[model samples]
Target: MNFLIISKYFYPQNRIASFRINAFAKYIRNAGHSVTVIAEGDHDMDTEWNGCKVSYVKNKIITESYLRDKIKRRKRWTVRRITASLLNRIFLDYNLFWGFRVFKKANKLFKENRYDVVLSSYMPISPHLAALNLQLAGHKFFWIADMRDEMSKHPYFSKKYKSAYIAIYERLFLKNADLVLSVSKPILDDFRKMHSSSNYLEVRNGYDYEEVYDVNFQSKFTMGYIGQFYDKIKPDNWFHAFSELISEGRIPKDSIIKIIGNNMKIKIPDNIINNVFEIESVPHDEAIRISTTEVDVLVMIHPLGRKGVYSGKIFDYLATNKPILALYDPDDVVGDLLRETRAGFTVKESDIEGIKSMILKCYSIWKNREVLPRDWNKIKQCRRFNQTKILLDYLSEHLPNQ
Candidate 1:
């Protein structure tokens, strides 16, 4: 099968969409499909990547200036990300033509090749619009639309009221797609409610075991959180919970709390700074190794957001099979997965006291048990490889090469 993956971002972007597309594309190629990825070739870029054919289209507008740096850093030094975010939101239109250029290239590819399927992942819903363009050009290839996070239904954008028009465009474009894929069941369900007749599937974000299982366990009781840090989801409650244990001397002063990813934007409270271990952004493999081997307990912390919004890290946490202390909204997707797997404990985001109790109890459980609860079968089920296998079966059944 000849598959064309249309995504705005791919490998090295350090984003959820990029990671999923990169992994899936590689897996699809490994499964004997010829895969080509069309993406934004902004700035100095390469034309191909590891077994996959690649094409790059230049962004119509590029902004790199002192003013941009000032805007980017404003959030780090102060509680001003929201302000920079609003200004940045206003400037997105300047690059609208980038999507159209890629769309044109995708259309040309469809016309020239006997493509079996066209998969477009979104955040920039431009890819879906691109797929729609190809379909309208008399090419009826199976159009698979991937949604990492909902467009209009996203808690951040829905509250901002910034991109209502684009959201409407996304819904209309997605409705016409041959099939839709989402990371969570609730997200897929939400789309189903919006478009009753459309077919949708859940292909969750997952862990790469090879990357995680290599690291030697560094310490016995390290509690760590990785991934982007945001002001809205600051670790205030997290610190408050740990503070209780610290004050009670239940948790040793030498025990570590490792934080990876973007911590510059959200300040870590000074009280816990002595025990905090900060590592700047590293490659995905390195981060994964750090999560599973270096950290004793994996922490899944999220802000109290609207229903169905779960951190992409939940699957990764499960893969480690480390005892998990998931701090999330009781009604969100993370809470749902915790219940389904029975692999971890969930403390409501607002319940500091309950979180402390869970933490202390987890410590007690760890001290008493000879081995950790590393459920290998349940963990394997949530991985990207298995998820991609399911996707492959779907493509073979619904969009087989003629």
Candidate 2:
């Protein structure tokens, strides 16, 4: 099968969408299928991935030397307006302007030689709409809509948008798709409520095997986190959870708290600075090696908000079989997974005392060398690669195979 993947993020960017799309494309290619990716350009404009072809597009008008020079001089003021006007003209979806040229090339390529399927992943929802355009142009390719996050239904949306407009748009658009997939059940449930398509499914994010099997677990008392960081994920809360340990001297004052992602550049609240050991972001393989060197506990933290905002890091953390400390909303998807594994504890973010108790308990478990029952065997069987196979099969059976 030939698969054309449309996304705004792809390899070398190292964000979630890029990583996820790369995993699928690699697997499908390994399975003896061809996969072509259309995405926004990073520092590298046009390139060929391992076995896959990738192309990028961006607006030419806004990229003039004069505009770039002016922005360089007054970036603090002119950037917003420049971005808005430039992006609107270039991309069908304003945010995905970098993919405009890529999509045009893809459309031309599709016309020359048809593909078996067109799969799109969303952050900027333009890919699906772009696929809709291709499908309308007499192309019989199967369209799979992959939603890594809830569109307008995300918790970050204002009440007005979620309650009214999004419901209608999601229903109308998704109804036309051959299949709709989300990373978790809550999101799938939201989709099912508005659209009764049995075509809907859940193909979750998973760990990379090389990251799990290749690295040596080297640290004795180091705690680690391996993903992007942002304001919503309060590092202070993590510090507060271990405050009792620090006060009582259970964990050494110099014990490492390594955070290995681009998030080091984000502004962190001053309260948490004393507890950290910083490492600059690296390539995925390097990150895996760095994370595996840690000996103590593995921590995954997210904002304590609505259910379903689980970072992809949690799955990778699970595969490592380290003692896990997941700090997230009780209702979040990652929290639910921790409950299912019974491998870790989920404490309320506000209950700093409870979080302290859990940390102490985890430290004790770490000391005892107790191996909790991890579902690594199950994880290997049900990752994104295998999930894509299942998705293709379902689409073939239910939708046109063409």
Candidate 3:
């Protein structure tokens, strides 16, 4: 079976969604199925990837170019947009331009070769719009709208467009596509309430293994978090949780806390500064190796308001085999996954005593040369290689001989 995947990024880009699609493309090809990807890039180019093919669709229009350049200049930070023009003129309008370009290119590609299945992955949601155009125009294919994250519950939308308009938009998107998939259950629940007729499912993100350096875990108790830090994830709260312990000298002053890849510059006491290591963003493999081998504990911060926002980092952290210390909401997907897998301990974001207790427990294990009681079999359940089987099964159900 030949599958056409439409995404905004692909291999060599190394974004969250890029890793998922890249791993799937390789795994599917290894399973004796051909995979073709339509992704965003500069200058149209074709390449063979693990026995599959990839086509690049260039964004060449003025509005698209202007928005792209502005984003590039801003270093691709969406939060930097503060004006109405940035909100109304570029984001809302330019994305449609991007959709038009994607549709034009995808329609041409569809004509050249017939596809058994069409998988449109979303981040910007332009690819879905483009594929929706082709599907609506009587193109025949089993269309699957895959949301790597929640589209309808996206936090970017303000009060004016949050609930009413986005819900309708999500319904239309799901109603048009034959099947819909999201990264978490809450995301599917958000869509299912409005569009009960469409096929809704949850597809958890998986970790992709890569090369890493061999690093011995240091004698000092280490807790590492290797990812970006933004408004929603409040690391300072964790510090406040430890304030009493640190001040009382129960926790070692030299105990290391590695906040790699991101540094929010939390104002810890002078005594703790030597123990706090803030590393700037490093390459993916380096980040993984450090988290997996160098740290005794991995710290993960859950978002405050984004209910269904499950970062791809969760599975990656799980694969590291280090016990996770999740400062999370019970509503976030990580809460249940951690409890179910027994891979980590979870504390409410505001529960200072709970956070302190978890750290002390982990420290006790580290000091006594004891292993974290992670259910290895359960942890394997979320591996990226294993996830391909789910995708393949879905394909077999929809298109025979997958």
Candidate 4:
């Protein structure tokens, strides 16, 4: 079978969305299916990766620098705001020409060799729009649209006002897709309610075991959080908990506490400074190398309303076989996974006491020179290959069983 995977981001992009697409393409190819990934990348950067072919789609407009320059050139703040708004309206999900370029490429690809399935993965929604374009152009392939983040429930964009226009594209993609999959069940449920006619599935972001690398275990009792941080997901509870522990003398003064990648941007209280360290963001491979081996405990921070979000980092942390201190919903999707794998502890976003308990507990174990014994039997189910196999089987079942 021939498959075309359309995603704005792909392998080497180092994002959660990219992990899923990269895994899908690699495993599908390994499963004896010919796979081609079409992603936003360097112009003419077509290459074979992990047993699959990759084609790049260059954006003619709406790049970060281009947008910044356009906005900066506007003298009036009001004019800048208006120009940005217009840009968003003109581009499909702020990716001007991405959809059109993909459509043209996909049209040609279909004309040359008809694909058994065309998987469109999204955050920007441009790839899905490309699939829609192909369908409208009368090139009907079995279209499967993968939603990394449920745009309908986007936090920043108000559904009633700001993203009303975005809703149109969302509805069209859902209505036209033969099957739609989201990374979590909550997202799947939301989509089912919105588009009952569309078949929905839960496709989680799994960690690639093949990419797992070794790192020498350090002696220091270290807790590391790898990934970008923003206002929505600051480890406030973790900080407060650590502060309390320090005051109580539970956590050693030499204990390592680091937040790698983007700055937390939250005001870090001076009390925790003795334990604090920050590393600039590294690429995905480097991050895994650091977190899986060096960090004694992995810290995962969940923002408000993350019930359905089983973060991609959790899978990586699980692969490490290290204890996780999840600052998340105690009973949410991520918390459930932690219990299932026997991976680590979960403290709610607001539970300072709970966070403190987990911190103290993990530190004791780390200090003892012991690692968390994970249930590999249960963990294997969440492996990238295994996850992709299930998805492919479903896709095969949906196809005419020849």
Candidate 5:
């Protein structure tokens, strides 16, 4: 089978969006299938990565350039705000311009080659827009629209100025997809609700478990949090809990909280200021190395009310084989996975006492040099290679004719 993957994010971009599709491309090609990737980049290039053919295409938004130039030249805040708002309403999404460019490129690619399947992943939504255009133009290949995150009903963008208009586009484009893939069950449920006639499946983000690292515990009990906090997924509650734990001396005074990323400014409590450390974002491989060897426990944060969000970092934490301290809604899929894998504890953001207790428990295990028992069998299933196999098996079973 020949696979054409269209994603706005791909290899060499140290982002969560790039990992899943990168894994898919590699493993699918390793399975003796031809895989070609069309990815967004600063410049166009035709190259091969991980045994898969790749075409990196440059993408630009005209309105964004115009807005920036106008704002810079005029220094008129009011005009800039109004113009941005008007443009947002007109475009519905900033990526629409890039989407059209991708559509044109995809059309040309289709004419030049025969593809058995086209898998388009989303975040900026340009890839899906391109694939949707191909479908509407009467292409007969099996199309899989992979949503790493939601679009129209995304929690962060739910109240955006053009959400309704975005929803209309989402429906029209996705309804034509032969199959819709999402990262979680709740997200697939939402898609099923929105497009009842379309087929939906869950293809989760996973870690590269094949890359192993030696575990070297930090001298002081350390807890590390990677990636930026977005929307309601702030670390304020966790910070408060840690402060209380330190004040009560429930945890060692030398215990450290290392935040690894270009996170938003956080007001550290006076008591815990000395205990907290911040590190700038590192390469993805280095981040994994730090997670595995430097930190005693890995921290994961999900918004209290959000469901179906398993931050891509969680899988990496799991691969580290270290205990996880996830501050998330106890009823969400994240909590469910943690419980099933016995990877770590899950405490709701509002449960300060619960959070403190979990912290102390993890601290105790580290202080005692005790290793937590994990479901290695279940953990193995979450590896990127295994996840890709599952996706391929599902595709084979469900779309056998293709």
Candidate 6:
């Protein structure tokens, strides 16, 4: 089978969004299927990765550059916010110009190649917009619309009118998609409610790498968190718990809390500032190595009240096979996953005492060099290769014979 994947995010991007489609393309190609990727890039270039071809398309309008420059010039926040809001109301997404370019490239490619499947993932929504354009133009293929996050019903939406307006486009895309794929079951269920389509599937994000490096735990009990904090997700509670633990002498004064790739301004308590080290973002591979080998505990933060959001970082943490300390509502899906895999402890973000207890538990495990029991079979099922197989199996059974 030949596949054409349209996504703004792809390999070499060093983003969590890139990992899913990158894994799919690599594993699909390894399975003896031809894979072609069309992705957003700074420059238009052709490249190859793991036997798959990729075409990077540059945006013509460069709206992002303009907005970035405006910020650099210290534009008024209120003015910029108003202007952005107005533009968003008109365009739905800032990538409209890029979406047009992608559609043109994809349309040209479709004319020359007999693609068995056209899979497009979304966050910026440009790729899906491009794919939808091709479908609207009468191009035929098994369209798989992968929603790593929700669209119209996204929790981030502050304006009901805007969400309602976006729903019109969402319905149109859903109606055209042969299959709708999401990373969460609840997200897929929500999509089903909007479209009344039975062609939806939950393809959870999985870890791509299997090679676990030898554990080189730090001398002091160390906790590590990778990636940025956004939308309701914050590290305030975790920091508070850590501060309390230090004050009570439950953990060593030298214990470290290292955060990588967090650009946001975190309010670390004055007492723990010496213990908390915030490192600038590193490459994805290096981040994985550090998470797998260096840190004694990996921290995961999912905001309360946000259903069906499993930050892609969790799977990477899972791949490390380290004890995870997830701070969110314990009743959420992430908590369930942690329990099912026996990989970590989940504590509610608001429960400071619970957080302190879990932290102590992880510290004890590290101090004793004890390996926590893990369900290797269940963990293996979350591997990218296996996840790709699940996708392939479904496509083989459901895709129209060509």
Q: Which ten residues in a row have the lowest lDDT in candidate 2?
A: 59-68
Task: State every prediction's TM-score relative to the real structure.
Answer: 0.87, 0.84, 0.88, 0.90, 0.91, 0.93
lDDT of each: 0.73, 0.68, 0.74, 0.79, 0.82, 0.84
Give the winner by TM-score: 2 or 5: 5
Alpha carbon lDDT at 230, candidate 6: 64
Q: Which candidate is the best by TM-score?
A: 6
Candidate 1 lDDT, 1-402, residue by residue in tens:
888998877865666667789888999999988999987664534377879988877654542232234444553342333443453477333335666787778777766787878898887666777878777778877788888887767765655455576567667866788889888888888788777788888888887664243233444567888876665667778888786678778777666788887535555556667887777767777877777778777787776765676667877778765777888876677777777766678888789888988888767655664335455676687778888998998877876544
Write down the lDDT that model 2 would get: 0.68
| lDDT leader | 6
Give the better candidate number (2 or 6) by lDDT: 6
RMSD after CA superposition, every candidate: 3.8, 4.4, 3.7, 3.6, 3.8, 2.7
- Which run of 10 residues does model 1 get worst, by summed lDDT? 63-72
What's the candidate order when arranged by decreasing lDDT?
6, 5, 4, 3, 1, 2
Candidate 6 lDDT over 300-324, as tens digits, reads 8876787887888888888687899
Which should have the higher lDDT, number 4 or number 5? 5
Clashing residue pairs, backbone N/CA/C < 3 A, model 2: 57-98, 219-295
Task: Give the residue spans of candidate 6 off by over 4 A.
Answer: 61-86, 211-214, 400-402
Which residue ranges in model 1 land beyond 4 Å of their true spot?
44-46, 63-95, 160-164, 211-220
Candidate 4 at residue 288, lDDT?
Answer: 81
Order the candidates by TM-score, highest first. 6, 5, 4, 3, 1, 2
Model 3 regions lying over 4 Å from their true place: 60-94, 210-216, 263-271
The all-Cα superposition gives candidate 1 an RMSD in Å to the true structure of 3.8
lDDT of 2 by residue, 1-402 (tens): 788998877776666667788888887788777888877663335568979988765434343333434543545346555665665444323454444454676789797777988898876666776777787767887788888888667764457744465556566568878888888888888778777864788888876664254334333556788775655666667776565567678765555577776433443334345767667667777766655666567787776655676678776676666767877777677777787765567777677777787777876766676666766556564466776676666755775544
